[model samples]
Target: MAKLYSKQKLAGQSMLPKKETIAFILNYSKALSIKKIGKMSFEIIAN
Candidate 1:
Protein backbone atom coordinates (compact mmCIF):
# COMPACT_ATOMS: atom_id res chain seq x y z
CA MET A 1 0.00 0.00 0.00
CA ALA A 2 1.03 3.61 -0.47
CA LYS A 3 0.99 4.23 3.23
CA LEU A 4 3.51 1.46 3.77
CA TYR A 5 5.77 2.82 1.06
CA SER A 6 5.54 6.30 2.51
CA LYS A 7 6.39 4.96 5.92
CA GLN A 8 9.51 3.29 4.54
CA LYS A 9 10.51 6.59 2.96
CA LEU A 10 9.83 8.67 6.06
CA ALA A 11 11.88 6.36 8.24
CA GLY A 12 14.88 6.74 5.93
CA GLN A 13 15.47 3.10 6.63
CA SER A 14 15.89 0.19 4.32
CA MET A 15 12.79 -1.38 2.93
CA LEU A 16 10.80 -3.30 5.48
CA PRO A 17 10.43 -7.03 4.92
CA LYS A 18 7.23 -7.87 3.04
CA LYS A 19 5.85 -9.94 5.89
CA GLU A 20 6.43 -7.18 8.42
CA THR A 21 4.65 -4.60 6.29
CA ILE A 22 1.76 -6.95 5.63
CA ALA A 23 1.43 -7.74 9.33
CA PHE A 24 1.51 -4.09 10.25
CA ILE A 25 -1.18 -3.21 7.73
CA LEU A 26 -3.36 -6.04 8.93
CA ASN A 27 -3.01 -5.06 12.56
CA TYR A 28 -3.57 -1.41 11.77
CA SER A 29 -6.71 -2.16 9.83
CA LYS A 30 -7.98 -4.31 12.66
CA ALA A 31 -7.36 -1.56 15.16
CA LEU A 32 -9.19 0.93 12.96
CA SER A 33 -12.11 -1.42 12.65
CA ILE A 34 -12.37 -2.02 16.38
CA LYS A 35 -12.39 1.63 17.29
CA LYS A 36 -13.38 4.86 15.59
CA ILE A 37 -10.14 6.64 16.19
CA GLY A 38 -10.38 9.94 14.41
CA LYS A 39 -7.92 11.29 11.88
CA MET A 40 -5.16 8.82 12.64
CA SER A 41 -3.35 8.97 9.35
CA PHE A 42 -0.20 7.14 8.27
CA GLU A 43 1.95 10.23 8.85
CA ILE A 44 0.83 10.28 12.46
CA ILE A 45 1.46 6.60 12.89
CA ALA A 46 4.87 6.76 11.27
CA ASN A 47 6.02 9.43 13.64
Candidate 2:
Protein backbone atom coordinates (compact mmCIF):
# COMPACT_ATOMS: atom_id res chain seq x y z
CA MET A 1 0.00 0.00 0.00
CA ALA A 2 3.05 2.26 0.26
CA LYS A 3 2.81 2.61 -3.50
CA LEU A 4 -0.62 4.13 -3.10
CA TYR A 5 0.69 6.75 -0.68
CA SER A 6 3.64 7.62 -2.89
CA LYS A 7 1.44 7.83 -5.98
CA GLN A 8 -0.59 10.53 -4.26
CA LYS A 9 2.52 12.72 -4.39
CA LEU A 10 2.57 12.45 -8.20
CA ALA A 11 -0.22 15.08 -8.58
CA GLY A 12 -3.46 13.24 -9.48
CA GLN A 13 -5.96 12.37 -6.74
CA SER A 14 -8.83 10.05 -5.94
CA MET A 15 -12.20 10.60 -4.21
CA LEU A 16 -12.95 8.48 -1.14
CA PRO A 17 -15.16 7.97 1.88
CA LYS A 18 -14.03 8.55 5.49
CA LYS A 19 -13.40 4.87 6.10
CA GLU A 20 -12.58 1.68 4.22
CA THR A 21 -11.04 -1.77 4.75
CA ILE A 22 -7.53 -2.52 3.58
CA ALA A 23 -8.90 -5.52 1.73
CA PHE A 24 -11.08 -3.22 -0.34
CA ILE A 25 -7.97 -1.22 -1.11
CA LEU A 26 -6.12 -4.36 -2.13
CA ASN A 27 -8.81 -5.14 -4.68
CA TYR A 28 -9.62 -1.62 -5.88
CA SER A 29 -6.79 0.75 -5.02
CA LYS A 30 -6.99 4.47 -4.30
CA ALA A 31 -4.28 6.70 -2.90
CA LEU A 32 -6.49 8.52 -0.41
CA SER A 33 -4.57 9.62 2.65
CA ILE A 34 -5.40 7.29 5.53
CA LYS A 35 -4.10 6.79 9.05
CA LYS A 36 -4.16 3.70 11.23
CA ILE A 37 -6.55 4.09 14.14
CA GLY A 38 -5.82 0.64 15.64
CA LYS A 39 -4.19 -2.67 14.89
CA MET A 40 -5.48 -3.63 11.44
CA SER A 41 -7.65 -0.52 11.53
CA PHE A 42 -7.38 2.57 9.36
CA GLU A 43 -9.36 5.72 8.61
CA ILE A 44 -9.42 8.10 5.68
CA ILE A 45 -7.64 11.20 7.00
CA ALA A 46 -8.31 13.19 3.85
CA ASN A 47 -10.20 12.94 0.56
Candidate 3:
Protein backbone atom coordinates (compact mmCIF):
# COMPACT_ATOMS: atom_id res chain seq x y z
CA MET A 1 0.00 0.00 0.00
CA ALA A 2 1.14 3.53 -0.72
CA LYS A 3 0.48 6.70 1.22
CA LEU A 4 0.08 10.19 -0.08
CA TYR A 5 -0.40 13.54 1.52
CA SER A 6 -2.15 15.12 -1.43
CA LYS A 7 -4.83 13.27 -3.26
CA GLN A 8 -5.59 16.39 -5.26
CA LYS A 9 -2.07 16.57 -6.58
CA LEU A 10 -2.22 12.96 -7.62
CA ALA A 11 -5.55 13.59 -9.30
CA GLY A 12 -4.20 16.68 -11.01
CA GLN A 13 -1.38 14.59 -12.35
CA SER A 14 -3.80 11.81 -13.34
CA MET A 15 -2.30 9.38 -10.89
CA LEU A 16 -4.09 6.72 -8.98
CA PRO A 17 -5.16 6.91 -5.37
CA LYS A 18 -2.58 6.30 -2.72
CA LYS A 19 -4.25 3.17 -1.45
CA GLU A 20 -4.96 1.97 -4.93
CA THR A 21 -2.65 -0.49 -6.56
CA ILE A 22 -2.15 0.01 -10.27
CA ALA A 23 -0.82 -2.34 -12.91
CA PHE A 24 0.39 -1.35 -16.35
CA ILE A 25 1.51 -3.27 -19.42
CA LEU A 26 3.52 -0.57 -21.14
CA ASN A 27 7.30 -0.64 -21.01
CA TYR A 28 9.31 2.55 -20.89
CA SER A 29 12.87 3.04 -22.14
CA LYS A 30 13.07 6.55 -20.71
CA ALA A 31 13.44 7.97 -17.24
CA LEU A 32 10.37 8.36 -15.06
CA SER A 33 9.70 9.84 -11.67
CA ILE A 34 7.78 7.91 -9.04
CA LYS A 35 7.22 8.62 -5.43
CA LYS A 36 6.42 6.03 -2.78
CA ILE A 37 5.18 6.89 0.64
CA GLY A 38 4.17 4.97 3.72
CA LYS A 39 3.27 5.89 7.27
CA MET A 40 6.90 6.23 8.19
CA SER A 41 8.63 5.93 4.90
CA PHE A 42 9.22 8.10 1.87
CA GLU A 43 10.91 6.73 -1.19
CA ILE A 44 11.60 7.72 -4.77
CA ILE A 45 11.53 4.98 -7.35
CA ALA A 46 12.66 6.03 -10.77
CA ASN A 47 14.63 4.91 -13.73
Local distance difference test values of all predictions, in order: 0.60, 0.56, 0.45
Better of 1 and 2 by lDDT: 1
Report the number of the highest-lDDT candidate. Answer: 1
Per-model TM-score on C-alpha atoms? 0.33, 0.19, 0.15
lDDT of 3 by residue, 1-47 (tens): 78667665655775455532222222231234445566555444344
Tell me how far the alpha carbon of residue 28 in candidate 2 is from the true structure, in angstroms, after superposition. Answer: 12
As a whole number from 0 to 100, the lDDT of residue 45 in candidate 2 is 36
Better of 1 and 3 by TM-score: 1
| Model 3 lDDT on a 0 to 1 scale | 0.45
Cα lDDT of model 2 by residue, 1-47, tens digit: 24567645556546655455656675455546556666665755343
Collision pairs in model 3: none
> Which 10-residue window in model 2 sums to the lowest lDDT?
26-35
lDDT score at residue 38, model 2, on the 0-100 scale: 64
Misplaced by over 4 Å in model 2 are 1-31, 43-47
Instruction: Note each model's CA RMSD in angstroms.
Output: 17.1, 18.5, 19.4
